[model samples]
Target: MDPTLQELLDGIGPRLRRIRQDRRLRLEDVAEATGLSVSTLSRLESGKRRPTLDLLLPLAGVYRLALDHLIGAPPTGDPRAHLTPHRADTRTRLDAVVVPLTTYPGRLQVFKQILGPTSEPPVLVTHHGHAWFYVLAGRVRLLLGDTERLLQPGDTADFDAGEPHWFGPANDRPAEILHLFGPHGDRFTQPD
Candidate 1:
């Protein structure tokens, strides 16, 4: 292993100990919370034992620390900013460009979506966030909740993601659109 990696692993024990002490948590408490023996926790904190996923996952959950922070892995290379376009099943292609407008208590994310001819509607997935979309060209079929509408060029739509929503090409031609996804209770805006 690289010296840097070794050094990082060596320091995790002390870091874990410091974090635990900072939180005023006892080894026994952590052990009980994580189903680990107190001696095993001590060995882990003292660097006598290498931490593994089985050990770290519970500790991370208990301590409220991300696994990456717990293990001190080197920062990954820049998250690729450019999109890797996905071609649809029906001669259609999409380029989803992700843009973050702000990073604060709530994150605002945006995507520029382009769809080619015959793009089929993708399965609707529900996750944490609200989304809004605007069609710039061609037609878009918006499936939100129980309602489905065909948005002509220059049309726009928005809705809560929790209620389930999906969008794709409405015809045999390609379509292009801009989508904004807000996590902080922000609504989508469109021209009247």
Candidate 2:
């Protein structure tokens, strides 16, 4: 076996364990989701069984990760991140496109968002998290409870997500923003 291949294979076991632990998933939970037995998962994580495509495919789905990232493949020296934008408004009728900026499990998630005016009145929602929004282009209107504010370029707002809040373009035109959402008990670090 090539030395590089051996090294890559050796690292997969630890990476699997680390990803599972980082996502706060238990072995039983993984087994149930991936349809792989707990003992098999344990052996795979312990490097007793060599990883095959069949084993990794389901794990990748459950973890919401690309195969390359899952196995820690060497980077292709590409500076650009081939990000896929996903819809943010699944139930609500808000028109927005969200490109995920970070993918670390069980941690703060960041996104670049583009939003359009809403036809219906904005719906305020509450969730267990903290969010910070920064306007990158155009204008964004933020409605939190009874308070309403229009944010322009370079403007920022950080608030408790527990408060009823919804935000989108202030007018008919589109707006762009950099959004950061941190889950419950997420502590943000500041550079010294």
lDDT scores in order: 0.76, 0.89
Clashing pairs in 1: none
Q: Estimate each model's TM-score.
A: 0.44, 0.56
Off by over 4 Å in 2: 1-81, 185-192
| 185: Cα error in model 2, Å | 4.1
Global Cα lDDT for candidate 2: 0.89
1-192 per-residue lDDT for model 1 (tens digits): 989988998998998899899999999999999999999999999999998888889999999988988777766754544454544342223333334333344667665667654444456656677777778888987777788999998887878877776677787776788778788657766499
Task: Please give the lDDT score for candidate 1.
Answer: 0.76
Q: Write the per-residue lDDT of candidate 2 for residues 95-151, one digit (tens) a residue.
A: 889998877567888889999777888888888889898899998989988999999
Candidate 1 lDDT trough over 10 residues, lowest sum: 90-99
Clash number for every model?
0, 0
User: Candidate 2: deviation at residue 144, Å?
Assistant: 1.0
Q: All predictions: root-mean-square deviation over Cα?
A: 15.3, 14.3
